[model samples]
Target: DAGVTQSPTHLIKTRGQQVTLRCSPKSGHDTVSWYQQALGQGPQFIFQYYEEEERQRGNFPDRFSGHQFPNYSSELNVNALLLGDSALYLCASSLVQGSNTGELFFGEGSRLTVL
Candidate 1:
């Protein structure tokens, strides 16, 4: 019954550094979506993974990459980080049936601070 879970609740990195954040979806959820939430802003969709493949992506730069494992877990990798990249990285899980994406359950998120 556990919902999505993320690791390294908090982290710090410098500009040009690289970071990877992990996520495990809730039981029975097969799709994972990653988002970036800046201070006082709504969560911005980064990408979505289904069936171990990237199904969609947002406007983020190429520095952002991700992978979905067979177990339905996922990882978000950001290379050449910038100060603007400092934000809460969120992982949301859902069940995808046909063209429908059911309700999303989100994790507490991994906080990244880039200096």
Candidate 2:
């Protein structure tokens, strides 16, 4: 009965540093997607993982990557982080029950502060 969850609710880093964020999908969800939301801007899709593979990716740099585990949990990793990377990292979970338009449940998000 749990919903999607993200760790390190807030993080701080400097340019050139690498950071990893974690997420746990909602109960009965098998698909996990990662998004970045800058202040006053809409969320931008980063990537999505299904069946332990990266099924789709958005217009993000290669430095942004993700992994999905067997338990439907996921991780987002950013290497060589830049000041522009400062944003709220959100994790959304969807059931994908034979349809692609299912509603997505989102976590509170992990806020990243790059200096």
- TM-score list, all predictions: 0.98, 0.97
Model 1 lDDT tens row, 1-115? 8989999899999999999999999999999999999999999999999999999999999999999999999999999999999999999999997887899999999999999
Summed backbone clashes in each candidate are 0, 0
User: Candidates' lDDT values, in order?
Assistant: 0.97, 0.94
Q: Report how far residue 93 has shifted in candidate 1, in Å.
A: 0.3
- The residue ranges of model 2 lying beyond 4 angstroms of the native Cα positions read 99-101
lDDT of 2 at 86: 99
**Candidate 1 off by > 4 Å:** none
Top model number, lDDT = 1
Q: What is the alpha-carbon lDDT of model 2 when measured against the actual structure?
A: 0.94
Q: Which one is best on TM-score?
A: 1
